[model samples]
Target: MASLNKHSIGGNIFLLLLAAIFMLMGVYFQWLYTNESNAALAEEIAYQKAQEEYHDSNIYYEPEASIRWLLLRQHPAGYFVPNPDLLFEPTQLNDNTLRATRYAISILYELGALDSINPKTIIEYVMENYLADIQSAGEVDGAVYHNGPYAGFGTLSSRPAAVRPTMDALLILNLLGGLDDPRLDLDRVNKFILAHMNDDGGFWDEHYAQSGRNSSLRCTSFALRALSIIQGHQKKGFSTSDRERITSFVVSTHDPASGGYADFPGREATDSYFVFRAFISIWSLASGDLAERREYVENHMEVDHTIDYLFGQHYLKDEGAFSRYYRDLQSVSSLKATNLIIWFMTSMGRMEVLPEKAILQYMMSKQNRPGEFGGDMYTTYSALSTFSRLAVSTEPMSQPKKPTRHASIPAYFPLMLFSLSLLTLITSYFTKKHEMEARNHILARQASIDGLTGILNRNGFEEGLEKQIGQAIRHDKPLALIMMDVDNFKDINDRHGHIVGDKILKEITRLMTENIRVYDIFARWGGEEFMILVTEAGQDKAVQFAEKLRKIIESGFFGIESKVTCSFGVAMYRKSETIDEFVHRADEAMYNAKHSGRNQVSTVPTSAKKDDRVVEFKP
Candidate 1:
């Protein structure tokens, strides 16, 4: 009987071995069928050299369609517009990863790619996969969830109290764009933040870090930015006095001498990013003090010296660092830093209401492969968002154009493709690759523009608008200009504080978006200032539209405690008017309304008298 049992066990083991071999064979065959066969070392070498030979220029995206095509194909889950290689990689999980996922989804939605995925599904996925993990770590005040494995699995004592993740979580909740699903827990997030806010009005990561410890601009900026979003989104919950206190704290944190804001009220590591965040937070709320601080950073804060300082820290590799101040420049991973920088530049653009074109071009030039740039998500987002925001800036760069059969090959690479019958089959593979790439480019461009405001930003506005503007002039179409300014904007900022002021502006942006037709263009031109372009609209029509916009703005669906109003200026195209000239005329008209009693429209012709320049209404 024992012999029989041993023989049976041996037979079973033999069967198991056979099954394992078959499974291995199946996996190999399936991989071979669906994907490219694994390249042998020799083949890989030859292919890489061929790719290099094929790409004459070092610029990855340009001149070589095949390479660009190959890189883009790797983007899984066609969602958030994938950044390029050299940026940062997304981790599978973290302690507060749910919040990061929320922010990522918002970015994708903001970019327009979120349409492909169900918002509910994505939200649920985050809640299940990431949020549950966060909740398991430790709860904060039973309401705010803190002490997570998101950053890392360190005890609370060992970790730096980071306000960025929490703030970001709040902003993500705001960006969910109004489905009051209880899963978001916005009130809980706010309460969490408020509980963390030190007596000094700045927020710290934990209760221990809340007192006497130095606060960082990185943390402070994220906290303020997040709080500003909260203020805009959840207006009723935060009291008027609390809003005032927050605003006052934001103002006080500004470094008077350097104009570069510190991370917290007292610490002084004035960085471009923190300064930018400070300015943007202020700009979003229209806090003149914050705007003034931005100007100080721009005009007074030495860029060259700061660059030198950063360079001195050995942080200026192909990829950049998250922060640098002291001689001992401690570094964070590149992904976080990259986004912070990109966001900083975007904020600066908002403050100046102009494009940082040259800087942006340099950043774009640094984009590497497959939606990554300069070694992390932070820098990649920074560069992309900055580019998106500054699309209309008067910076000179090469315009994007569709490739044609007649298009000349880049002068460097001749005889790169030997047009043979067998090669044609190989070339067909490349052609399909190129087509996929072209589709992605289109999708990515479309996703990045904001839908409501016909202006290019946060998605679709940046790429297309420039092409359209260039095409319009090439085709000689009349372009009408309108500049609209929110009246008593400062009053709103002061009364309700910056958060409600932001909501008011966002609502006004929505209104302007609704009023403009398909042929027209509108952008959040500056803080509480909007610019509109009407194609082929005559002076009479422009004036009429301006009046209508003014009336519409005055009607105020913003629904704050008090009524809001706007003043507008209209300018029709002139025979030889520059973009700047057109904008200036509209600006002058807007100023006229400001000087004239507020909430009125003024249409200025190209040729207006000096006295007419400052048109005054009856008191």
Candidate 2:
């Protein structure tokens, strides 16, 4: 009986162990299944969302007709916004003037300016006539803006640290919707911003260029906006660090006392005008949880005072919209204020409060008989936007309807997140699957390299040459290309069984490497042909380098049994020349050297005005 009981106990223990193994196996399978299912569902959901957002509506605003008719009736040539007798002329504020004009161009574009004027021509005019005076965005040394009111017209009287012309230019271009223009020098502007970043994650105004961490709300807001625009073109996702820092800076600057934001941290006075800009810029960068900000604004904003100021119905009660509050009190019907309001509302995606119909009517009524508006650029933009929005919204929308905040789509954020997640999964799967393929690529590269010769195979050389020449032009560096062909390479191959010929070529490459500088690039031009790139070196230095390389080849060989020599032709790159033209010049020079006598270098004239002269090598 005792033996039988012991056997039963052992059997039960074995069964329990078996059950536990099955449970673990089941859990693993379930996890695998859930991951696959969720991934597919995520993709499908994203696709549907993309399709929904991409759908364009052919909707028109009903109120635009009234505004257009009014414009036609009063202003025969152009439309304008009403300008109340404001002491601060929008045109007089240099930064305001720059921004206003740019806003005008943007409105004009929306009004079909491209159909009337060439976009490229407009860009050219801005670059040549305007960009110099504009304060560059991002971080800049104050020395660049030392002259008083140099760019944006912000003299000591108006702003203490205002030098935001660069921001103005970027905003203007954005308003014109020309961010993708290849001609725009975004790289330079991006570099400028990078220089001005303070240790506290905010940008300093020109007034405190490098003194310390003097942050301003206006500067930080504008900087964030410019960075957001520039980063859109970059392929790499912006790291969370960048987003976090910008959000913190903007949030810290908020004024607890006034229910508004100061231009920067520690600022005593808070203004709603700068608060709007800061919020808009922060939103563009996707810097913070905007939902929280919206909650704060709803619960804390000084609503009554803010509203009174926007329409000029109450002076001093309303914070001036764009850094000129005191002056704004004089211009009761100034269109700059109206445009500022519209811009803020639009940026926040809160169109309901903008009084679209009323603003449009006011703007249209101000038009002169000559078809131009009496108001400045700011007024024209506000009026046009109000009219256009009204024309497009087929849905009968009313004024001052509290919008459901944080309801609008980010347009890029969600899509980017989805794309990034998808990419991560795909990359992980492929990395495992193509582990062997990755090895094969490395092997393939090795195979293309002739170990002894140190020159690329014909395929590699062709690819490398194209890439190097392209890089040279892109960086605007000097490129000296040399194509060398052995005058009697075939004879050497015929006499020496190709093995000796290979050794000769290998020796030639070794000799060239020793004679060339680190920046100078050399590759086997082709069968007996060779190429060299003299980076940042002028034509004279290139010629000297080429001569030295040719002499080394003339004197050196693999074995004393065989004497080998090469002829070289050099040519400096010309802006207008194609790759073929540039290479052909080198080839012609090489042939000239071979005919003139072997073991020599030949070159073309580098002077821009000189005729293309070919000089044969004596050494």
Candidate 3:
């Protein structure tokens, strides 16, 4: 070995010093992490201990006092006092109306104290405010659409028609044995509700419809319950296809991840309110006992997962209540959350899953005046109803096992993440930009799909048609257009109903889908009509396929009395002709089939002229 130079020795000393500095920094970070973790863990442990102490304290559910509070909400004249803020003050013109009246009566009925108020007086008030004379009914409401002679109540006394208020009135009046009252027209009411039931199997209030919003579960529940009460049967009022559509809508609203039903399809449930309404709508749709009801619900949603969810994600020990949302328990009202949770539990018939002591204590804490729960009538009704349900359950109380979470992530995690992600974020910027563009492309593609049948709509088909025409022209390739429409579809709709018509359309779509080649483009062209573009195929191949589909359609039943059949017209593309002229020839041929007794395949020969016109072909 050679003797070491002074420069080498100096380099070694500098490296050792750098390593020692790094070690010291590592030690400092560890101390900071440990200190922060201990503080959070201690806080968590303290919160858990406090919750335990609260749970140990005995709480009582008072019956007589609750009845008294509900009674206090009622005026001496028998209608429920409208405002809890002012007790019995009718602040608005229609303040003493059906909403408070229904909730108060419902609460009293739930608590087994319906006899506390005179039923005759309540019915009289409901009739005075809600029931309207058809011919002599006052000026029509511009905000709502109401063809008179239908039974429904407006939001206000002067208002003539609405869905929710009508539902409340129906239940209240029926509970008081006012169904047989001559002033109340059950026939018109039935028609009124059926009108609100959209093809999607959900109900819409004409009031909310002004905002261009679709159906919600709350309104759907009201419509279903109202129709049931009107028909005096659980499941007889709705048609088979109508029931199918309704249940399908309910299924669409179920959020698989949260195991709760949303306000509408393709959404996570936001609160217990939405969950409660969803379950109620499903319950009202089912026509049997508990097991059958469970089965019905299972067909639409994940029952076991939902039942398990109640004990998992939402309940928190520190809060000692089930939070309104599954992901958020902090910074929420314990009173309303606990109350709504109990209500939802009872509605789903899963009250057995609840931790009895915590729910009751939290719920009862909202009652300050003998018990004026929820500051208003709606929540009051919810709380009282929950108490009644709980009074009957024999389930044991046990703390819910909280979902697995990081119990002690370092409090300075955000700072660490910021430092760690700087380099990654810089590298990922362009990648993220490309990802957003791809997402936008996919969204644009999905927009062309039909909402009902999941087929291409007319607009999408036309878009593809232009592209295919361009390709055909460029390569001088053969192409054909086949247009088909269901024979006597309007007659079928009149005989069966729109629901049956929609189902038949879907069935026809499925039949055609199975028979067509993958390259062939099939689309729904508005009502009862469909179009297909056969690429690289002349009129002969297109007509043969059309005839084949027509036979298959006639062979099958499409949820209706008569067998469904299609009339088809096939036209070969002329290399010299425009798309409009090519399409017109197909339309003219299809009409020829229609005029010559339908369910027949009619084709324009390859020799047909580009400008030939069929005089009797009607659109």
Candidates' lDDT values, in order?
A: 0.52, 0.56, 0.70
Q: What is the lDDT of residue 58 in candidate 1?
A: 25
| Candidate 2 C-alpha lDDT tens digits along 2-65 | 8888888777666545444444444344445556566656666766665554342222333343
- The stretch of ten residues in a row with the least summed lDDT in candidate 3 is 610-619
Highest lDDT model number: 3
Off by over 4 Å in 3: 1-57, 82-88, 92-96, 131-148, 209-213, 233-236, 308-313, 325-331, 334-340, 347-349, 392-619
Clash total of candidate 1? 30
**TM-score of each model, in listed order:** 0.39, 0.37, 0.50
- Model 2 clashing-pair count: 23
Candidate 3 residue-wise lDDT at 102: 84
- How accurate locally is residue 494 in candidate 2, as Cα lDDT from 0 to 100? 71
- In candidate 3, the residue pairs with backbone N, CA or C atoms under 3 Å apart (3 or more residues apart, or in different chains) clash, namely none
Residues 109-197, model 1: lDDT tens digits: 43445444455544443333223233444533335444322321111222232355555444443455532556555554444455556
lDDT of 2 at 383: 53
